[model samples]
Target: MLSARQRQLDRVRTFLFGSRTHYGAVFTVFLYALLIAIGFVYLYPLLFMFVTSIKSPEDLLNPMVQWVPTQIYTENYAKAYRVLNYPQTLTASVVMSVVPSALQVAVASLVGYGLARYRFPGKGLVLALVLATFIIPPQNTVIPQMLTYKQYGLLGSPLSLFLPAAFGQGFKSAIFILVFYQTFLTLPKVLEEAARLDGASDLRIFLTIALPAAVPAFIVLFVFSVVWYWNETFLTVIFLEGGVTTLPMQLSKFAQAYENLYPPGVVNIFDRLNEAIKMAGTFLNILPLLVMYFILQRWFVESIERTGIAGE
Candidate 1:
């Protein structure tokens, strides 16, 4: 009985400290630590922005006030909101970003479906061209695009953005197409064949079967499109030419706008109001995106995981 008990204890010790378990535990700890460090590095800037935005002018001037403010200045947000023309700009951003994103998804899905399911002449060539388009920078074609838009009288209109997306040439459209292509290809053929044998039309089969399976991809693409379009400035500045002013563009020009709106003596160069307003603008600009991400976070995560599974 004593010998058996001793052997059992030895087995338990070996199991706990065995080569496989020990290596796995060490790797897991290292991975978690690395992730935490990376998260802190990335989040520090946003944290500072929030802290500074809430600081009063007096608190900001005091060298002692670094992390926390003695008094929270909520008025910064109010002033920032007025400076940004939040109501109008928010409407413009949603129309510009969300509309184009939805249109691009529709165009990409159709193109990807055709490429994946059909065998046409020059099929390989078409796929190669799509891949080639991914490598070509958008800036290289901006000159020609501007010229073409000018000829069509689309230079100052939102149509310039929408038409390209409607025709399957939106920003980073190739990636979206690839995602759908891979997703459609991964679906089992038996499902489609069964529908066909039941005398269902191709459209009916796609709408009923294929589209449902690809819901995850759609959600993922929509989120990405909104973020990219929201953050876009350089292209919008050129295309719209002051016709549209998004949150980012407004934030970038906050100082000039502020000076124009108020008297010079109202705020000094190093005044906390100046910096705080800008910080508050930045925070408000991203607030909607933050809300959106939090709301759809589960769907977004599931979409990515599902896309990976489909690719595999």
Candidate 2:
């Protein structure tokens, strides 16, 4: 009976503490708890924003209301929608982000492929320059670029944003370049050699053999580029301030725009701009980004896995 009890105790310990083959029940519970804690930390702000956005003015004023509102009030969204000029600004944002992202990805891929696959004069210098560009703050270059754009009459036009991307100089272009470079470096060169032996020209070999293998990298970079471009406000304000208005651009000036739409003296105090309305605007500003992220989340995970940088 003593030996049997000892064996039962050992089995229970093993079940709780895990074996070489599998995790234990305790570990699984702890891991899930940690994940839930981390998830809450990241999701709290979004939850607060969404809840606040739907709160009525009365709920906002009521001290009793914190996480949950008494009722869902959508008036804030209606007011915010008009203040943001959602339809027009959303279109502009999509154009601004997608166009530059496509151009940036294309340019980065070529630059990365060249850096990874070729030996050239001043290769070290070129790489050093790309890294330097990545490290350098955009503030240092924005004024000069703005002036140049003004001089060339490209200011406030999409070309002002596009030209740099087309030349592999878009915002965070260096990172994407490095990503592709690393991706290409990992690819087996034997395929390229085989293509070459088959009488494929350099460009043809790259197009047929190398580019297809780097599709995952391309998707990852493009998605990230789109997010960066979509969220960029500083350069957009400097270059496209007068001519175009993106969601971020409009969001920054939400208060002023709200006043313009509904003057304080003309409207009742309850109808005036409030935190709920501001939260609504903020939520609207990020809604598209959330949608995009959710839709492409699987692609992002898969691409990251394929790029072999998931651990990184």
| lDDT values, one for every candidate | 0.82, 0.92
TM-score of each: 0.87, 0.95
Report the C-alpha displacement of residue 172, candidate 1, in angstroms. 0.5
As a TM-score, model 2 comes out at 0.95
Residue-by-residue lDDT tens digits, candidate 1, 11-64: 776655555436444566778899999999989989989998998878878999
- TM-score, cand. 1: 0.87
Instruction: Report the number of the highest-lDDT candidate.
Output: 2
Which residue segments of model 2 deviate by more than 4 Å? Answer: 310-312
Candidate 2: tens digits of C-alpha lDDT, residues 24-97: 89999999999999999999999999999999999999999999899999999999999999999999999999
